[model samples]
Target: MSLAVVTLKKGEGRLLKSGGMWIFDNEIASVMGSFVNGDIVLVHDFDGYPLGRGFINTNSKIVVRLLSRDENTMIDEEFFEKRVWDAWEYRKKVTDTSSCRVIFGEADFIPGFVVDKFSDVLVVQSLALGIDRYKEMLVELLKKVLAEDGIQIRGVYERSDVKVRKQEGMEPYKGFIGEEFSTLVEIVENGVKYQVDVKDGQKTGFFLDQKYNRLAIQKLCKNARVLDCFTHTGSFALNAGYAGAKEVTGVDASQLAVDQATANAALNGLSDTVKFICEDVFDLLPALEEKGEKYDVVILDPPAFTKSRSSIKNAVKGYREINLRAMKLVKDGGFLATCSCSHFMDYELFTQTIGQAAKNVHKRLRQVEYRTQAPDHPILWSADESYYLKFYIFQVCSDR
Candidate 1:
């Protein structure tokens, strides 16, 4: 039996008992001995009262991602599969299609792992050292479980190419489990079809998290001129065009991405209604404003603003600058669809930044429909960071 101890300070163990997972560096009183990354540990109160069992990694900021409260049982594939099945049942009740995040890290009681399903294929990304240790087991179980549900395991590609993985002393690795699938895969979301790039595209090859939020913008883009900044593959712009927008212009820094967006528009048979421009979104937005261009709806979904606390100040600056410019580009009574995926920057902080941007630009926000990750990406109360995606759709009331 694996035995170790993680001592929590006097009252800090309260959350632990209350089902709050994640033992931060400060929460631990001591290891009481040496422990390797992914070693199973028994958590205890300051007085050594038995708390629960979880995996530990001294190298990561989050020291532990607890698995169970039972000590008699062992943590293995069954333990993980049980939790995953429960999550799967919940998803089946909520979603009809196979497209969604099947397992959400802490929410599924298996921290450090996330699995997103797109039709028959599965995309997995591991962020924690402990989770990395069980990567094989989890993937095996996930593929098996998915197969039973009529989901063919097209590929098991790793998008661990993220920045956080480097901090854990891991390198970037990505490819198909056997052989790569066609980078171009057709995906249907809310009755709208999109061409996705899985091998070399963004996270999971598509931002499925914004599935519903983009649909919301579609509801408002009727007969409107729309601008989609940072339009990676033109999710927002495509939705606007499908929703009967008078016209939609997509902008991004990647020429290849712009080409994909153009192809996607044609795929949707809306090429005449949409166009793509390859350029920096910041510079392009300013030029559009200078050209006396005013849009009825503007979408600003930039990449993570802050990767760490140290970069938060600059992130705030970047978010505010772009949001302020987006506000100006919107005509009176227009809509602004904006978002931030930086977990370090809280929703309140981003809200304040956007509110300040509105004030500086003399635009009044008429309404705010704050949204988070899609139903597929469950937010385990134990881990707030897992709930990173946020959307703020508001009416840009102007003096015009």
Candidate 2:
């Protein structure tokens, strides 16, 4: 069967040529042959040089998401199995496979689809129509690949209920992919146990991307007072407790999150040392400052302040405000761990914002270390969107 061909305009396809998988609508010069949206299509340069094969969708600005650099490559079960196998092998080499992100969208060379494993359960999120069609096959392949390593998957759940699906001309969906099982799954990370609510919890239950980051805080928390803001499910706070912190306080705005976090603390036998509070971090930080309360370690793991470029100014202000407040609450020579998970807020911008916050608060920050998301979520260079997380640890000291 002949495949539809899409030709890119001259001087366009720069990103695609530079190892990125996306080919935007504006980059196309012309199209030949008939093809339906979400169908595999051939991509070519303006002069008719064959580029590769990708799934095309006119509904999205990202018109084409390349699947392979070889135009003649078959898009079948065998093809997908290889993708799944490679992703799993990479994870085994770099991260603990007990529970981690199995596929990280474009970074894993499978764009607009994400699969995160929580113990024996797998949560799949398909954001683009092209990948949505193959979600079932990918899940099955993942199960097969995992079974090769003696890991049996208990169930599969779909969490494609994101607004991004609407942009792809597909309705958001959520539910079991196969047999229904308990949505609550327990998983341990860095000696901390968490009950992940795959059905109602945040994206794919818990934030596995911060697995190592949570572990990184343990050494700093021993016998120290620790404050964890935006403490989702007490991951960081519990890690601090397990590290034998004298006292730990985790703050979040959602009562549900606070409840879950509290439960996790008890699950890990850290309830006595780590306590979760249902309050806005922004509001609580200033109140804590007024009470002359200071901590030996302060952790700020706030959600992305902005998802788009337009809202970046507001995001900067939000990051600056919280960081300035957190810095002030850090006792002299105390450690501060802060991070931003927004891809739009690049590393340079986030670092500059932290610098600005320190200056405004009259604090001297001695850099300790810098980090990003865990290796399971590999950052594909030149694919800017694939890299989002930026983490920094600094020692906060009073000015002379």
Candidate 3:
């Protein structure tokens, strides 16, 4: 069958040309040949120069999500197997494959598909129509590749119930991909145990992107009083306890999260040192200050304040407010670890926000180190979306 062709207008596709994977609808000049959404299409520049093949979806703003830059490459099962293998191999080299992000969507050259391996269980999120069609095949291929290394995958869970699926002309869905087993799976990271609920927890149960970032905070926590905000599952707070923190108080808005975090603390035998509170960090921060509370180390890992560019202005205000409060609660010459997971926040803006917060609180920030997501979640340079996490560890000193 003849392939559909999508030709870009002259001087368009600057992002694709610069190594990005998405081709927006606004960039295309015309489409020729018969094809339905999610079908593979050949893309060409204005001069008829072959750009490559990608999955097309007229229903979405991202008209084409490039699968390969090589026009000859087929988007077949064998091709997908190779892609999965490459992603797995890369993770094995950079991180522990037993619990790490296997396929990071566009960063792994497989757009809109993310597979995270948590021990013998795999959690898959298929967010695009083109990739969703091949989800089953991809899971099978992943299981097979892992089996080759004697890693037996007990079950696969699909967490594609995100609103992004709706934009791709697909319904949101969630459940076991194969035979249903215990949704609660245990995995150890940085010597701390966690029960990852693949079925109902937020965004694939646990935040695997901060694997090393959690470890980074542990070093500064030894024998210190620590405050962890937005303590999802108590990863950082538990790490602080494991690092010999004298006291650790974790705060989160969700009761479910607090309960899970408390269980995780007990599982690791750190309950005595680490305790979780179900309260809004915004309210708790000021309340703690009013109570004359202060800590040696304050860690903030709040959720993404803004998912879209339009809300960035409001998001910055939220970020600044929390950072300002956290800084105020830190003891003089204490450390503050803050991060923004929103891609729209960007590095420069996040840093500037923190600076503004320090200035407002009459504190001088002495930078210790700046970090991003763990290596498993590789940041593709050209794809701005791939680099979402920005973590900073600072020593806050009273300016007075």
Tens-place lDDT digits, model 2, residues 103-165: 999999888989999999999999998988898889989999999999999999999889889
TM-score of each: 0.93, 0.99, 0.99
> What does the lDDT read for residue 374 in candidate 3?
93
Clashing pairs in 2: none
Write candidate 3's Cα lDDT for 1-400 as tens digits: 9899999999999999999999999999999999999999999999999999999999899999999999989899999999999998898899977799999999999999999999999999999998888999999999999999999999999998899988999899998898989999999999999999999999999999999999998889999999999998999999999999999999999999999999999999998999999998999999999999999999999999999999999999999999999999999999999999999999999999999999998999999999999999999998999999999999999997
TM-score for candidate 1, residues paired by index: 0.93
What ranking of all candidate models by lDDT puts the best one first? 3, 2, 1
Work out how many backbone clashes candidate 3 has.
0
Model 1 per-residue lDDT tens digits across residues 1-400: 4587888988786566777787788888888766777788888889977778888887777787787887656887888888877888888887645578888888778877888877767778898887888888888888787778877777667777787776666776776665667656687887777777777787878888888888888889999999999999988899999999999999999998898899989889999999999999878878878898899999998999787899999999999999999999999889999999889888899999999999998899977588987877777676667778879999999755
In model 3, what lDDT does residue 144 have? 94
